[model samples]
Target: MDSLTQTIYECLFGAEYYEVNPASDDNTKAADVLRALFSANEGGEHLKKSVHDIVGERGWTENLAKAILGGIENALKQGAQMGKTMADASEKAIAEAVGFARDHPYFCALIAVGVLAILMPWVLEALGFAELGPVEGSFAAWWQSTYRGYVTKDSLFAFFQRLGMVWH
Candidate 1:
């Protein structure tokens, strides 16, 4: 199975990926030692036995030296896998975010508004947009105009009525 599928399977099913350590050169195998250190009341005896099995499988006399070398090789391979996994995961996450934005435009607009509010000052100064407003007919006066041009004052009452502010 692919490494990502194997990892997900282990996470979801609590299944052992190996009865003993696989002879794979993945540095993450050494991470068991770190996990043993941080996990309270935990022992890495299983991992030690696995390493010993690895050494014996190779007919190595010195367990510690073999384990160290194997760990370095394991770490190197795992590091490459980790980098690829991160890049792939980031792409998927971005695609998911785009999907979410498509499904919920109002929520996305609110988020955009909040971000704009926070960055408005820097953006205004950088783009020199602060000097423009609809008061004298700048883009800032966007609320007063449409793509077809400015709305006439005759529609003011109609606009208020559309907003549920009708006066009898």
Candidate 2:
């Protein structure tokens, strides 16, 4: 293995180099090793340390070292900016949703009721208020038998009746 490839391998893996003939040129081999390290989900700090160690040992020209370091810094800055942008967007969306909910209380209440209606069966089952047994027959028969008691008219009427009492 070439000196550059050997140095990179040692810095990144903390071991001696093993020759793998994937690339003909030294630069390609080095690039391939770096790419593999990244693809393996190696942490950024480890990669940065390896690169710094490699640069120091290789005795490259000052300009080349500056260029490489500048590129890494730029990439880090862009990543931070992208993360900030996403966080700001999420905050804005949440604020808008809260504003809409506050402005349209009745509409929000209706939507909540609709969502609760859809999720009530699973909610009840999770809370041990409803128990579902293994399927025994056709889909229609199972659905009917499973939900009939939980979703009957008396239960819904009682729920709304209680809700009305709470309002009064």
Candidate 3:
């Protein structure tokens, strides 16, 4: 049976591919360590054992395994560091987007009121079948209609009517 570490490592990085050249001092084994870190199934003990098995299977003497373990450790360590960087970048992007929206108050207000206008039908229904007039030319009504038209091909009036609250 394969060692648990080997199993976990394979689960993580088995999909990675690298070309090896027999004549050169290629460090492709780092690929295995990285894959192990990225795998969802890995655990600490399993990873340590897997590294031992991998180096052992590669026919590295004890001295060589000790030497190569340093490089392997560095590779997996860097992969984790890179993952942190990517997550930080994503968080920063969302923060910037929110800041931009806040800085553009008029655009944000327009969106908020438009959403409110969209919900007006439900508001009226809750107020007990109030006789709301036709939205043929009023500014709020016209804006909603034009906006809905541009977005959904349904006239704003028609969209509100489908909510069973707003009239034409």
Candidate 4:
């Protein structure tokens, strides 16, 4: 078996077990070690303890430990770079959207009005101002009747009077 696999076997199963077994094939040894680690009762706890022992007993050299740490640091740096790239892309998209809206105020206003018109009935129903009941004819006829009922000259005058009061 390889030195790393031998060390792992010794760490998990003890030196006696490693010497007694002496597996010729590295793959078979590794699989056997995996089976022993997972199939045992309290396997997770055993695995944790074995890993602690392996580190504490200096199963790996200083250079090997440093290499593992370097790999982790590199992975973290790459993740941070990826996050920065995504943030920059999102900022660019938002800036473009704002620029478009600023350059086409009339178009934006028309779009807003269209959206409001489509949502008016649902808004009115939600506010307990009207019910979306069965219509006699088309949707346009129903909307016209509903609009006339709520938007009379008296209501318009009342609204303007309230606005004037607010301004004053």
What lDDT tens digits, residue by residue, belong to model 3 across residues 85-120? 334554587799799888997666556645755666
The residue pairs found clashing in candidate 3 are: 145-156
Residues 2-90 of candidate 2 have per-residue lDDT tens digits of 78866644443333222433232333334443443334334457656665555456545544433333333333444422244334554
| All candidates: TM-score | 0.26, 0.25, 0.26, 0.25
Model 1: how far residue 58 lies from native, Å: 33
| Tens digit of per-residue lDDT, candidate 1, span 104-136 | 997786566446545553432232233332234
lDDT of 4 by residue, 62-94 (tens): 433443343333333444223343345545877
lDDT for predicted candidate 1 compared with the true structure: 0.42
* Best model number under TM-score: 1
Task: Tell me how candidate 2 scores on lDDT.
Answer: 0.45
**Residue 156 of candidate 2: its Cα lDDT?**
38
lDDT of each: 0.42, 0.45, 0.46, 0.46
- Residue 41 in model 1: lDDT: 38
Cα miss at 53, model 4 (Å)? 40
105: Cα error in model 4, Å: 0.4
CA shift at 138, candidate 1, in angstroms?
12
